[model samples]
Target: MTSKGLFVSFEGIDGSGKSTQARRLADTLTARGHEAVLTREPGGSPGAEEIRALVLQGDPDRWSAETELLLFTAARRDHLERTIRPALAAHRIVICDRFADSTRMYQGLSRGDLRAAVDQLHELMIGQEPDVTILIDMDPAAGLARAKSRQTVEERFEDFGVALQEDMRTGFLALAQEFPDRIRVIDGNRPEEAVARDVLDAVETCLP
Candidate 1:
């Protein structure tokens, strides 16, 4: 790998299996003799992980959209400093589970119409964008059911129910269009192995 490295992120609605795919990509790349650093947003570094708990747990309305934005930005900043940048500098492929685009959809579009604010803050603080992003698109109802079945403490977003998931799916698809060069949309309603193969093909194109 070149010193410049490659940054990749996996995105999708909850239960769309993006996290699983991200991990698989990292493992696959590593096995193929590449140095791959797999991490996640809202909780990649220590400080960010703490912020993740705050935002992901408790009641659905725990924080206002504006406040949540601040927290997410701060966490991302810490994650970049502690985890992402170093790995990139070392010529490692950074496969992130979720990144700024997730924020653009979840906190920016879903919580409220704060897309402008999200963009401005991102430019000012975390200006980095993924070299490639794979978005797993799934049916809102089925995705919601899968998310709810997890029964994890991090179900605050899931608690908002299927209505929010439906809106999120539409928002995410629009986001893919907005950043066509960087984001690739993949159908996630199929078998996991098939989705993984598609994801690998997508990332391989961007590999150095």
Candidate 2:
């Protein structure tokens, strides 16, 4: 990696296996002798992790769409300040599980028509976009099934049901269209190794 470093975020509907791919990419890069900082949003830093517990482990409607947006934005700000920026400054590859695009979907488009507000907050506070974004495209039904099968308490979003997942899948694909240069969509219905290969290919252009 160059001194400028590289930021890569993985995005998908619940159970799209993006987290796995993110970790695999990080491990792959590290094995190649590159310093990679693997992290996740809403919980990357200490402060953000606290915020994560609040938003993730509650009733589906524990927080309103707007309130959730604010919470997510605040967490993102702290993450940028305390974790992401420093790692980039040190020239490490930042492999993030999710980023602003998530807020754009979950709290913005999917929850309500808060995309405008989401963008406004993002530009005002977290003015950084990942160099590359890997969007794992998966069937909403399948994704929701996988998500529910885990039975994790963080299923507040998943608890919203398959309809929400379907909407999110469409919204995510649209987001990829909106930012064609940065977001690359990969089919996640395939084997993990195959998905990881495509992910590596998507990111290869940005790597040193």
Candidate 3:
């Protein structure tokens, strides 16, 4: 990736509209003459996509939390190599729908306590973080309602119900505080246009 490019990620609870906003931001950047590569977690690259099916499909209890962590880390390493890094090396703005932060939140929620392991694994195998992260924050109930409307085969995490979503919101908010320098939490309960504007403004601050 060229030194001039920026790396950005959009993170939030499942139905918080982070993925939509990530796409919108990439479109905005492209309209303004920047090359933005928009991709999603566990499936951004060939190998990663393969891993995504394994983790996102089947029974939610199919894989142990520790085993799940290994799968995600492996996917991330592949994503970085085949997708993110090359885009950044070319100076393109890399806008990821989800990244390592998702791992910390999801695994922590499932296992009750595994965040330390997530961090350690990330540092050891996938050390890079986004130049900026836009976290779409909203009520968990609202987000869960939104999520339930979708028709996806990847229903493993969403099946955890609203209670888990509430816990996930807390986890995401905590992550924002822990990484204040790079994380920006934006209210995502508003219209998509409003959220898109906020996302754009947050990312623009980190751009060259």
Candidate 4:
């Protein structure tokens, strides 16, 4: 396996089924007798959940890109302090829906040069990263359609339209290239079971 138990995170555009797949993988692992701790970024812990509401439910321009990024970082920091770090310490597989990678892509789209700032914040504030990041790669258009099917105030970012989704797709792909050892790109254009099969396949090999 990779280490003892794995700290896995699912990454992709909003509608790439990362959240669903993260849960599915966690459930699968539990059914197999593994202690998989399922969580999500910006809302895993109580403090973080408060931040999630602040960040995700509001006008599209409620917060500037920089402000929004900091909020995400803060929520992540809280989540780590209260949720993720403890789970990893207990040797449980932690499968998170989204992590710092989403911040890197979304904030980078707002301002291309902000990646430097985001990286700095991540290194200084939220030092830990996922052991394995599974990127559910999908076409921006198709993913957008999937995202829109859900009605939520989180539509702020998605309302930016196809161009933003396109850029995010490119950004996430580049991330896979940058962190090849820690990241894996999986095709998300398949059936749920097929996608779940591939996700679990990627995870099981690294199982403790």
Indicate which candidate wins on TM-score.
Answer: 2
Tens digits of lDDT, candidate 2, 4-123 = 899999999999999999999999999999999999988899999999999999899899999999999999999999999999998889999999999999999999999999999999
What TM-score does candidate 3 get on C-alpha atoms?
Answer: 0.96
Candidate 3 ranges with C-alpha deviation above 4 Å:
1-4
Instruction: Give per-residue CA lDDT, model 1, range 113-177, as digits (tens).
Output: 99999999999999999899899999999988988888899988898888888888999999999
In model 3, what is the error at residue 42, expressed in angstroms?
A: 1.2
**Candidate 2 weakest lDDT stretch, 10 residues:** 1-10
Estimate the TM-score for candidate 2: 0.98
Worst 10 residues of 3 by lDDT: 1-10
Give each model's whole-structure lDDT. Answer: 0.92, 0.94, 0.89, 0.88
- For all predicted structures, in order, the TM-scores are 0.97, 0.98, 0.96, 0.96
Give candidate 1 misplaced runs (Cα > 4 Å). Answer: 1-3
lDDT of 3 by residue, 28-110 (tens): 99999988899999889999999999998888788888898999999999999999998888888999989999999998554
Q: Give the deviation of candidate 1 from the true structure as CA RMSD.
A: 1.3
Q: Which stretches of candidate 4 lie over 4 Å from their true place?
A: 1-4, 110-112
Task: Record all residue pairs in model 4 with backbone atoms less than 3 Å apart, i.e. clashing.
Answer: none
